[model samples]
Target: EGDSFRIDEPIYLYIEPIGYTIKENPKSSYEFGFFADFTIEGEDGKVLGGQKDFAKLDFKSWNFNTEITLTFTYTISFFSIQVFPQYPDLFSHQDNQ
Candidate 1:
């Protein structure tokens, strides 16, 4: 069976926000929540994963919840890499924040 992919093989994953609504909080960062359906599609247009009505975005800052949304444009991107057994930790413990 050659159906299994190799560990070092490269894959592409893309994320696009079809629609979203923003609410202004005004004191600090932007306090925004949205209801959207998303799908994880591979380079060949095959859907690997998806979610409906999912809203789980958290900010870990003192003024996180108090952030007011202002007139701004944002761009979000996603990337992935294959980690082999020979490689060291991609991220250090302290870098997790």
Candidate 2:
């Protein structure tokens, strides 16, 4: 995966969580679920935006599966270089590009 992404481009993520809690379902199946939160930060450590519980996964299986994969997709549309009021020229340069 690259560190840089274009505006409004789709970003894909694959995650594997360890030591997550598993519960027994009423139907004699095992159940597991998780929620994820995310934040977008600039190089200067300023939090640009974020979402709580942006992705959620729940599963029920007959076997206690040790391997699980979670996939998440995100698109950044609201982010803008114009956020920096102190850098008017920077915004203009981006527009010219």
Candidate 3:
């Protein structure tokens, strides 16, 4: 009974893709993956599922020291799956006249 959710809060986090060119490193493999990055045991007991999606950052037009933020949005679903929203950091508002 600890899984509480806020209707107006964001549960998903967006990751921006950084296309860093790979140079030959003597100590590391050319292609490797990080295993089991997240482990959670909050008061909310246990989480059923989660997902991640990212967009490419256009570095050609990026400022050298700019702080960029990527956003991902998701919704909780039944049957152990998360219904994710398309795109990131999207908010709908009526146009101000």
User: Each prediction's Cα lDDT score?
Assistant: 0.37, 0.69, 0.34
* lDDT, candidate 3, 25-52, per-residue tens: 4544343222112222223335333333
The ten-residue window of minimal lDDT in model 2 covers 88-97
**Top-down lDDT ranking:** 2, 1, 3
lDDT of 1 by residue, 2-91 (tens): 222333343333344434444455554454554545554443455545567655653333343433332212122332343323332221
Q: Candidate 1: what lDDT?
A: 0.37
Q: Which lDDT value does model 2 have at 95?
A: 9
Candidate 2 RMSD computed on C-alpha atoms after optimal superposition onto the true structure = 7.2
> RMSD to the native, candidate 1?
13.3
Which residue segments of model 2 deviate by more than 4 Å? Answer: 84-97
| RMSD in order of candidates | 13.3, 7.2, 13.3
Q: Quote each prediction's TM-score.
A: 0.26, 0.76, 0.29
Q: Which window of ten consecutive residues has the lowest lDDT sum in model 3?
A: 87-96
